[model samples]
Target: MSLRHAVLAALLSGEYSGYQLTKAFDVGVANFWYARPQQLYLELSKLESDGLISGREVVQQTRPNKRLFMVTDAGLAELARFAASVSKPSFIRDDLLVKVQAVDHVDVAPVIAQLDQRAAAAAAKVEILDKILRRFRGDLDEETYLRHGSPIGPYLTCLRGRLFEQEHHDWSVRAAALLRDRATRNGDPPPVSGQSR
Candidate 1:
């Protein structure tokens, strides 16, 4: 999906400054769509120019003035159109996966190290996403929240992100352990201490 649509969808909650939008994208939107801060700023300008969003300057007494933005009527229509369109299937294109694919033919030490790193990163993300999901649900239990929550889209997406990260962490740990076991059984020398490769 285009960053255009992502930005517009983000503004659906309410007005946000460029900085606020970037923060929102970093936390809430990063799961499904990844955009650099510069790219987000550029897309905001383009959307404003196209009349898909409107911006107003807000003055602060102790800080520089900032422009807050909200999606316009045209932006909603564009989002609706995008929602109605058929989505292309998603595919994985990971360098780590490529390395894993060739692990049997090459040195497995580096691949195992990378997998361990990935497992740690994914575990961290799972923890973060779990906290976010808790915040989204508030005092309501998961079952109750699914039946009665407002603004469920973001919560649903966050749930998907948590699940993906959890699975990734589990798989990475499993793959690393399996490789280590195989290396040991084959009498390959252990990876040197503090050696990532």
Candidate 2:
């Protein structure tokens, strides 16, 4: 999916200045999509020009004027069409995955370190998501909110992000452990197909 769609989805929450949108992307949308502030600013201009979104200048007492953006009817229609369309599967292009795959041929220390680092990052993301879920759910418990909350889309998306981060954390820890275990063996070949060669 394009950053355009992500921005549009964010505006579904309500109107936001470009600065606020950048912050929102950093905290929430970064889980599934990442875009720099510059990219967001540029996209906002494009969206406004395309008539997908409209911006209004806000006067401030001390600060310079900033434009707050809201989705236009065209934007909402576009988002609806996007939601109805079949999207291609998402794939990762991470360099760390490639390194992990080639661990047998390369040094293990760096790979282990990278895995540990990734695991920590994933854990951190899970914590962030948990906090966001709580804030979003407010007085309701997870089960109740999930079962009866209004506008459940964002919560559901956040749940998916949390689970994905958890999976990454679990996999990284396990991969690191297995690599360490293999390193301890004194030249014993790795077991293959239920037997050691």
Candidate 3:
């Protein structure tokens, strides 16, 4: 999805200044849709020009005036249309994945280091998502919140992110182990037809 849609969805929570929206993206939307603060600001300008969102200038005594943005009715309609439309299948285009695929022909040290780094990054994301989920749930218990709290879109997405990061971390660890083993056995005898490779 485009940054425009992401920005529109973010505005659904309420009005936010450019800086606040950037922080929102960093904390919440980073799990799924990644956008830099510059991209958000540029999209905000486009969204305003398209009449999908409106911006109001908020005067401040201590700082420069900031523009707070909110989604317009047109924006809501656009978002609804986007939701109804089928999305194209997403394909992985990760450099790490490419490296892993060609590990047999490359230095194992850097690949192993990348895997560890990725696992750590995934763990960090899991922590961030967990914190966001806790804040979203507030005083409500999990059962009560799931049954009768606010709409669970954000909660559900956060949960998905948490689980995905966990899987990524676990898988990375396993991949690193397998690669290490293969590296150690690089000159070992080839397996017989009936034996495991």
Candidate 4:
């Protein structure tokens, strides 16, 4: 999907400065869509030129002046159009996956470490997201919120992130166990006269 639609979707919540949008994208949208501050700013300008969004300069008391951005009708329309379109599924392109795919020819130490690191990062993100979700609960399950109130995109993506993170943790623990098992056996005698390969 285009960054144009992503920016519009972010603005759907409310007006946000480029900095705020960048952080939001990092924490909230990093799972499915990724964007940097420069990319968001460039897209903001492009959106403005394309009549999809509008920006206003906001003067701050003790901070640098920032441009606050909001979605225009055109932006909302574009997002709606995107919402109606069919989306193809995407899969992981992780370097750690590359190592796992070639495990027969590669040492497991570095890949194990990388998976461990990724699992830790995913856990940290889950904690952060849980906090955000708790703030939104208000006597309703997050699932109800997704079904009834507010835009479902963030909630759905957040669910995806939470599920994927859990999978990461589970996969990492399994992989680590296998690696540890191999490590433990590496220095042992050859399984009673090489019974099997």
Give me the candidate number with maximum lDDT. 1
**Candidate 3: lDDT over CA atoms?**
0.84
- Give the per-residue Cα lDDT of candidate 2 at 168: 91
In the range 48-73, model 3's lDDT, one tens digit per residue, is 99999999999999999999999999
Task: Indicate which candidate wins on TM-score.
Answer: 1
Runs in model 1 deviating more than 4 A are 192-197
Please list the C-alpha lDDT of all candidates, in the order they appear.
Answer: 0.90, 0.88, 0.84, 0.77
lDDT of 1 by residue, 4-78 (tens): 999999999899999999999988889899999999999999999999999999999999999999999999999
Clashes of 1: 0
* TM-score preference between candidates 1 and 2, better one: 1
Which stretches in model 4 have alpha-carbon errors above 4 Å? 143-151, 188-197
- Where is the poorest 10-residue window by lDDT in model 1? 188-197
Q: Native-vs-model 4 lDDT? A: 0.77
Clash counts for all predictions: 0, 0, 0, 0
Which lDDT value does model 3 have at 8?
96
Better of 1 and 4 by TM-score: 1
Using TM-score as the yardstick, the better of models 1 and 3 is 1
Quote model 2's TM-score.
0.91
